[model samples]
Target: MSDASLHNVTHENEAQFGDYFALLKPRVMTLVVFTAFVGLLAAPVSVHPFVGFTAILFIALGGGASGALNMWYDADIDAVMRRTKKRPIPAGKVTADEAKAFGIALSGISVVMLGLATNWYAAGLLAFTIFFYVVIYTMWLKRWTPQNIVIGGAAGAFPPMIGWLAATGSMSIEAVLMFTLIFMWTPPHFWALALFMRNDYDDAEVPMLTVTHGRRATRNHILGYTVLLAVLAIATGFTSIGGIFYLTVAIVLNAQFLWGAIKIWRRDEDASEVDNFVVERKFFKLSLLYLFAHFGAILLEAGLTRYGIEVL
Candidate 1:
């Protein structure tokens, strides 16, 4: 209504937009969107271009909203942990109230938009993904249990299945196997990071594997999950989506993964001192690539299929 009031309103609007987008957790959203896109495209049916775009957009938005909610609820731990310290809420780019409100709004909008653009099944899965991440994983499991990542991995592993359903309005065994590969992959990936960043979890009073069971146990767990992941990763080769390209990628990646796991397995994390865990940190980074490259190969294989190259 007046000049000072108008300026304040404009600033608030700008801040709100920034926080809303922050709720989308763009970095995490990128991975979700990319994998979801790949899954949608690789499916047996064709999705209209516009429909495909909209499904991926909402799926990414759902991911971001979950991240925002995580940041909102974990603001205390985020501030204490080095890895999460710079998130919107903890870094003060967005207030806790702003992030909470923003995350909830986007959560609703993304689910609703996805249902309209695709099918209710996809939208329902997206809704469950958000609830599981925000409520079950972030709020409950992370604080209460060392097996947090083990069970909570389901949230991160859902994007591809959501994409598959978005394309076909049904879930297939191929989608489930893709889900299985990522589910089995999650604990080892995250526990490797925890092996190195033990202090972060310790400082936050979170019962991460590194904190609750000790590094020796965590390393053994990593080796175990790596074996399970290796088996599933390779077995996927025989499934419908598997091709020569996918199988090749799986073998090479799993070999390197096994080598890294064996390295972690053989070495004693506690023997050399806390600093010796840097090897674990490097392995964690590699695990990130292990996922990206595996999915990228699937994309390549799908492309070959579309062109009728038939490299299966």
Candidate 2:
């Protein structure tokens, strides 16, 4: 082959690999893996190290499968949305049929592997999570209602619970509390993004709150959810899974999050436009830190408890 032709082929091959990986939504998978890992470690039951590793791997695969299926189903909307226009399927780097097949394959493999590595209960939760994200949220709720994220958040919230179950093969209040923390945190987190990316949702014709309700109403909803989230998050710090370390982290983060939400609620659209949605963007970024820090603190508490180092 000619040198130029060989170079072109190499570039295309490299791009193809990256594009397929993109379909998995690796960034989202990071949260899945982290939360699941924390959940497993935080459980009172001990899991073998290798078993825990494989369990988390399978769980991450399940999350990635959900992302791929979501992209497959939502390719049309994704193509139209500024934020999602370059996703592999929408960018024409992968076919919808291929994505669908890839997702289904990953879903089955992840579920079966997790069941073998841990228990069928955790696998069942993983399967349900994939189904909820792909069929319920992506295909039905996302286009159908402005409350999509509220109900759909359960899919994401399942990872830690699944992790807990993988460790203990049962449920507990601590697992439920971890699940609720993410569940309550989801709406405001996405709403802050919607506040800044209203036009993207509008263009995609997705029924996000900012598009259905006015920005004012969206702001109100953010504050409302943030208040509830703060309450739940701080209260979780007192649970069996929580400690002085967790409670201290929760108090500081929730205070900052509530303050951010209040700022978002008080601002008008004009002020937002004047500053290019700076507050919304900051809150959105802060939301990312908020969850990670909370989980990290929980993981620390778990480690301390395991070592018989009382954090209280």
Global lDDT scores for all candidate models: 0.87, 0.94
- Give the C-alpha miss distance for residue 226 in model 2, angstroms: 0.5
In the range 1-312, model 1's lDDT, one tens digit per residue, is 788777765343345566557666787888798889878987888899999999999999999989988988989998999988867677667788878888899999999999999999999999999999999999899999999999999999999999999999999998898788788989999988887776998999999998998988998999999999999988887776888888898999899999999889888846536667767877888898989988888778778877789743
Model 1 lDDT on a 0 to 1 scale: 0.87
Candidate 1 minimal-lDDT segment of 10 residues: 9-18
Models 1 onward score TM values of 0.92, 0.95
Error of 2 at 304 (Å): 0.3
Q: Against the hidden true structure, what lDDT does model 2 obtain?
A: 0.94
Q: In model 2, where is the ten-residue run with the lowest total lDDT?
A: 6-15
- Misplaced by over 4 Å in model 1 are 1-20, 270-276
In candidate 1 the C-alpha lDDT for residue 251 amounts to 97
